[model samples]
Target: MDRIILHCDLNAFYASVECLYRPDVAHLPVAVGGDEQMRHGIVLAKNEKAKAFGIATGEPLWKAREKCPGLVILPPHSRRYLHFSQLARNIYQRYTNRIEPFGIDEAWLDITEKGMDMAAGRHVADDIRGAVQRELGVTVSVGVSFNKVFAKLGSDFKKPNGTTVIARPDVSRLVWPLPGERLLFVGRSAKNVLHKVGLFTIRDIAHASPRVLKGCLGKAGENLWRYANGLDDSPVAMVDETDPIKGLGNSITTARNLTRQEEIRFVFAHLAQSVSKRLRKQGLVGSTLQIYVRFSDLSHLEHQGQLPAPTQLEDDLTREAWRLFQGVRVQKPIRALGIRLTQLQSVEEAAQLSLLWNEKKRQQTAQLEQCLDQIHRRFGPESVRKAPGLDENLVSLVRSTGVASLPGRPHAF
Candidate 1:
């Protein structure tokens, strides 16, 4: 039997979720993100009605509003969206354990082991979409194929509440003529490189020599070349609690160039807390903390410091991040700031605290974070955030700039 992968994506997730509560606005052009006064606000997600008007994700809200003056803008409800995502995942788990959540709105499920053919898989996808619509009042799109890359592409072939199946025999016909950008991992740089070699489409890249592509893109290039040919072999590993973290980082692009010392410190504290929450979520700790600042002129500054002990403590990380920020000379207004934790080690494998005082502090910090996590989990992320970081303008800016990568779908053989 050929491997079968299914990519399921919520249709205009945030917008759809909002429509569940405000059904009257279902037919209107809607966008989800920050308020317009927050000049840095960008479209996070848009409903089908809005997409029809040329509104795209990451497009500046100001421009989007101008294009569709009647656009109904809604504030982001991350907690609400996450709740729907969990519900979607619960439903997916019923079909297969080989499920990989790409993000809050997308996931991949491998159903090859069920011995179902493409038609059966399409039925399953349609059923899942129906379940979400009936139960959660949201629409979803499912793409059925033999690999993650193709499955993802298939899902996008249809829009809100649509499904497309790409059989193994028909894969090339469907994928070849598509633009290079439509292929996974083909960013601007990769696209340019591919173009330079006269390989501007998936078909061109797939037919190019793997050795030549590898020489150009290194390992990543090689992977893309393979992906274009519909040859992905990656499995949808169950999300393991013990997996080592790939990276820990937080960034905020200020609404405007910031010059105040207090404001900078406040941003650092917020970023530290955000990073710590992610660390705890993954059961990981880090030994190195790095801080970055992008000045108004686009010049950047970065500082790194080794922690005396690996930690996932919000206080420790925040204090260190603030100190690093203070150490830098602000010759110009700061456009952006970021904090990252690297040199990761699993919390379970990390050594215990040495000194009695140090041990006591570590225990206390851990307990505090656990409590905070519980509260945030039950209430909302904003429920327990640092008081100083509650500057609405700044918070909106940070939320607007955050990257949202769609979850990876399961790969079929």
Candidate 2:
């Protein structure tokens, strides 16, 4: 039997969640964006009304404003969005455990294990969509198909509160006419490559010669051909079946370019704190520390170093990031800084204290950061920062732009 898959995508997630809590702007052309004065300014999400005015996600906030002068811009609330994402997932849990999250706002579910036929699957899709709308006050677009890739594309075929079912017999009629760019992983560069080779539509990719595709586009060429032909067989993994997280990192674009060590250290400390908090939450530690620096000229530098041991402590990350920053050779002022913790392993798998290092001091620092995490959870993220004499303006700019929220970027679901 063909697998039954459904892709659930929350519509305008951030903007919709904002409207649910703030009824005053629910009717207006609202968007969730960063503050322009802080250099984090960009449209994160927009309502349907905003979409009508050509405002799009990740566009410059000023451009969006110009398109619709009355566009109401709201600050992002990450915690709230996280809360709703979980709530929406709870609704999906009622149907199947074979749920694979694509991002914070999108997930793929396999209902094939339930032994449901196409008719039954569509009913389940409708019920799931209706339940989310009724309970969460947010609408979802559901795509019902027999495979994950097609299921995702089906969800995108409709919007806000619609369901699109691409059944076995309907693929040729419903999907082939769409451009090849509509398929997942076919970005701008891939599209240009496909078009250059005369694969302009999904139908073109479906009928293209495999020998020619492999030679021209490499593995991606064959992958797209298979996807276009509905040959995808990837499974929707259960929550626990998902792959272990590779890393935890956070970055921010400063309000002004930073060149001095003091300014860089202040930013690195905050970034390290953010990464550490997330690592603790996941009960993981990283042995490799990396930092990315983007200069004002848009050029970037990234550096990585091996740590003595795996750690989820902020001090370890901060020290390693600072050391890496010191080694970076860039003449330009840095407009942004990013810290990444890779080479992850379970906290239980961490190495024992080194004979060369002080064990008591390491334990003490870990305990302190854990306590601060608890305090931040209760009071707020801004409640207790470990870095002293940190520039308040810099701190606030990073804080307002939460770790999960990046300007001019779309959620890569």
- Model 2's number of clashes is 0
lDDT of 2 by residue, 1-413 (tens): 88889999999999999999899999999999987887767798999999999998877788899999999999988899889999999999998888998778999999886567777778999999999999999999999999988999999978988899999899999999999999988877779988898889999999999778888789988888899999999878896675766777888878778877877888888888878888888888888898889877656767899988788888888899999888978799887888888888887666443421466887788788889889988998767665453567556546555554232122221
Model 1 compared with the native: what TM-score? 0.75
Using lDDT as the measure, the top candidate is 2
Q: How well is each residue in 7-53 modelled by candidate 1, as lDDT tens digits?
A: 99998999999888888888899999765564446798999899989
Q: What C-alpha lDDT do the candidate models reach, one value each?
A: 0.80, 0.84
lDDT of 2: 0.84
The residue pairs in collision within model 2 are: none
Error of 2 at 156 (Å): 0.9
Give stretches of model 1 more than 4 Å off: 239-248, 259-266, 273-284, 288-336, 346-348, 352-413
